[model samples]
Target: MSTFGELFRVTTYGESHCKGVGCIIDGCPPGLPLTEDDVQPQLSRRRPGQSALTTPRDEKDRVTIMSGIEFGTTLGTPIGMTVPNQDQRPHDYSETDLYPRPSHADWTYLKKYGVKASSGGGRASARETIGRVAAGAVAEKYLKIVAGVEIVAFVSSVGKVELPYLEALEDGQPIGKDFSNFLDHLTREQVDADVTRCPDPATSERMKERIMQAKEANDSVGGSVTCIIRNCPIGLGEPCFDKFEATLAHAMLSIPATKGFEIGSGFGGTKIPGHLHNDAFYRKADGSLGTVTNHSGGIQGGITNGEHIYFRVAFKPPATISQAQQTVTYDGESGTLAARGRHDPCVVPRAVPIVEAMAALVVMDQFLIQQSRQASATLLAPLHTPHHVLQAKPQPTV
Candidate 1:
């Protein structure tokens, strides 16, 4: 269960407050040029103590590549990486020994395994994402090299401090003017320009204030991240049970604290009739077919349609807060428990890279699977349908 991906599999190890945490990546293509530099920037962005709004955990989150590369080139072998826990304070979590943190993994983990880590939330800790981010960097490198794919994620909302772009559109209403532009060319620098990572300067400021309010109150806030995957080739997702959007949803919801996942128009798409919500097709100047709109979120029937794939991931407020709450202990005795530890007041800011990483993993694995299928299918003779069968359903023109 710890492993993710089929061809580009990654199995994460270690835990919060343990010696360290990392992953082993299997099935990476051979001879790709990679180094610590490619992986470090994303990890640095995900690490703690970056700004006033985040936890002051003071971890460099420096990664050490143990194998799978020699002199900056992959050898078609498993890749290993690790990031040590330099600032763990197991003693800080002494209160958890008497009680399970509400909405955290403590109670369920104990009930399932009959034991749990004494310090941090064990596998439930956000620290567990270090391996995901690292492995994602590798998969992203390959995707970029082979298909020029690009992935970016940013905080879109922090407790209602949201961009106007995410607002649901009514029938005959058009998308926000900047929505397409934002998804098409937004850069990580533009996203990382603000501490809240919300992309809009004014909105980022509001999100920052919201997070600070929670930090000051010894409470926590929740928010959502919007991610975009551009330049994905057509026919990437598996239909039936493993649709592209479904796999993406699986990937996003797997992260710690994730509560919701929506692609394209998501829930709002349900408001309009088929005619108004449909993405009409058009012929591009280059003679290729394109959609006049992207209500499908760059996918059609669970496969990429050569448009930007955009989605949103919602994270719940961190449960491990310093605020005192009346809750039952392990033995059913109720008492006031105030948790102690360094945790993000709003996880969206730090969650941006994690979201991007998971997106890359999903895209890369799906790409490899589809690519292999196409390669094998190319060797077979083409299916020649009868003219009557093809004419039964008239296809539309651009």
Candidate 2:
């Protein structure tokens, strides 16, 4: 189930707090330029201790390319990559095996597998997502070069300060009039101005104050992320089996702490009538058909319709709060457990990059599938030949 896609499959492996985590990408086109450098930047964004708001665990998160490339280009083989755990605190999790943390997967995993690793939630840890992000970077690069596609994701809500998109602007604007513009407006000093990553100077300051209060109380908070995909080609998804929205949902939910997902008009459509929800078709001045509205979110009948694709994902607060909580030990005895290891007070900001990465992966995989079908159809086209010239040429040769 970890493997995804037909023409552009990727399989991720390894565990959190383990020796390392990695991914193997198959079906990548040969001779595409790729290297470790291409994937590392995204990984750095997801690594812990990158900012004051995130966990204090310092992980370099350096990526090592193991195979599938020669001289910085792909060999049309499976690309293998790994990132070592440089700052593991196995000691912090030694007691976790004996007393599984409440609200965590420890008990469920034990019931399912009869045994589980003690260190850092084992495979269920958020650390498992590093491999996913790294692989996604590769997919993103491919999408940009091959299809002119771009994806952007940012924290739209932290607890309650929601960053709404501007109504007049399209989703793909270089600096869309909402959070995108806010991000652009801030300088590097402004970015470091707040721990919550909110672009509003005042709002960011207040969010930081609230997070600090929660930290003092040994608690955590949750929020949401909004991602936009631009320039996706129409007719990219297979109608029944691999709808674009379905694939994207699968990828997004695979991340840890993801609780809710909604595409265009999702639950909101329930409040509106069919007429209000439907996207009206119109011809543009450029002689191209376009939709006056995007209630369908650039997709119709499970296929891309070339409008901007956008969605939102909600993440739950990290379960490992420092406050003492009631829990059952491995022996079925009740005990009080308080998590000791480093953890983020809020995970939404760091998750922005991961969200964008997963989106890129889904889009790039769908693109490859679309391209393969097109190539096959092209090869099947009829060819024309000159019969008279062929007969005369044969006679002259004789």
Candidate 3:
């Protein structure tokens, strides 16, 4: 769907190689500090050509606020923004009209709609995520100010190159910092310092080499982006069908080229026995409940448990490649088509911001829903109180 979320709604518009792309953010709480500056960072991060690993196509991707703010503060109306498309080479995709790139959305989109945009994958292009990234920046700001929530994502793996797993501390002495510390100290600077976006310098080098190798071979590589949401409050999700993780999976998979989503123990937990997989709870030094382990990934029963919400998103390699391959044209005639265009040899690096954006949207949406529920219940809290226990008589309005 073009619109996402129940309370903090966001509707994205425009397409790849189009005039511009952006989003309308509705339901943003009033008086939150907001501006083009807040949204531009994520857009810049998602933009192509900043590094050798991504596509050469470069558009400043600068955004302009069209509505819904006054004096650098949100007005709680539908916030409209747009970023004009520049440097679009529609001619590069001219051949795609006749022959859909293998594994690309060209064919499926053409089938769904009788007519399709001749240039780019239209909305299926990674460029479509610009709006999401923009709207997410707004949501992120709200979450940070209201809840002290921090969201960050990085390229966790590229092809076979993977960072070492977060194993338990030596002899259960808690060698590593706890989830709060990890989230507190994990800054975007550390991630952006390297081209691969992997926090570890060594692993980032290997990941960059892998992307360069794919570019040299006229091929592509797939990888995963891991995101962490810290300081999220408990009870920020619904039960049953609308579980937090389920909605989170839906958001992550909505991004172009995304193939998988995993939270907490995810698939690996299946191998471990229940005892090892379960996160044991205890009272913390602050007199608050805490979990000794985080196998649950900061969530249990699909709700945030005040722990760090950690997850990974797997993205397939960008489908458009320079390699020649035999494929059928739109008319079913056999042909060999070699795609030509500026495309990322690997998408995981650019996907880091998109992953973080989507995470922020989910968290913000859930937070708003929970807040509304709590507010309504609290408003009616004294309605059913026992008459004998009432301290003072209710005052009457004139």
Candidate 4:
């Protein structure tokens, strides 16, 4: 269960305060022109200490490629990458050895494994996500080069602060200067311009203030990230259990502290009648098929529909807080605890890249699966040689 994907698989390892955190990515296409440069940006973005609002743990999180490539090109072998953990303070987490933190994996891990890593909640820490971010960056590069797919995720809401809900607008509707083009126009630069990573200027400032307020009060806050995937090929999903939305949900919810997952018009669509909720198909000027609306979030019947794939991930408040909390100990003895450690006052900003990474992993996996199916469809004859014909191999001269 630690690994992800059928093709383009990634298995992550290491813990919060371990010697390092990294992943081994298998099934990446060869000759894709990859290097540590292709994977580091996301790691840097997801690293702690990016701003005062985040944890003060200062880790450069520089990644080192260990194998499965040569001369800056992939060898189609498993690519191993590592990012050493720096600035670890294991002593800070000694208290967790006694009392399990609320809303965290401490107790569950202990119950399941009968033991847990004594430092920084071990693998349960958000620090474990570094591997996912790194692998996601590589997948994103592949998607960009081969499929022209593009993805961007931003902090859409922090506590009560939120950006404009642009998904509600009709096609070509505008909220601001050319806001109708947001699906294609929004860029990582615009989102990263602020600490909160919310593209809306006024809203970003408000989100920052909310984070600071939480920090000052010795509390934490929760928020959501909205991700948009554009230029995705149509028909990239399977029906029933492996629905596109279901896979996306699985990926998004796997992130640490994620409390909810929603695709376009998600919970909001419940208010609309069936007719309004349905995205009607139309022919585009290019004579390609499209939809007048995208309420299905660019997917219909579990398959992509050549429209932008958009979704939102909700992250719970960081469970570790400096505020005093009352809870039972490992022995079930009642106790009051004021936990101490480096933690984010708000996690949404940092989670932006993480959300994007997880999304990329899902999309990349789906792309590979779809490519295999499409390739098989191109066969002029049976994919395998017919048994009778194969059995008639020319008799070799003795």
Compose the digit string of candidate 2's lDDT tens values, residues 309-386: 888899998898888898778898998887888898888878877898889888878887777776676788654567
Model 4 is weakest, by summed lDDT over 10 consecutive residues, at: 389-398
lDDT of 4 by residue, 19-54 (tens): 999999999999989989888888889989998989
Task: Please report the candidate that would top TM-score against the real structure.
Answer: 1
Q: Which residue pairs of candidate 3 clash?
A: none
Candidate 3 lDDT score at position 389: 89
lDDT of 3 by residue, 94-122 (tens): 88877988998888888898878889888
Candidate 2 C-alpha error for residue 113, in Å: 1.2
Better candidate number, 2 or 3, judged by TM-score: 3
| Top lDDT prediction, candidate number | 1
Candidate 4, residue 272: CA error in Å?
1.7
For residue 109, model 3's alpha carbon misses the true position, in angstroms, by: 0.9
lDDT of the candidates, in the order given? 0.89, 0.77, 0.85, 0.86
CA-only RMSD, every prediction: 3.0, 7.9, 5.2, 7.2
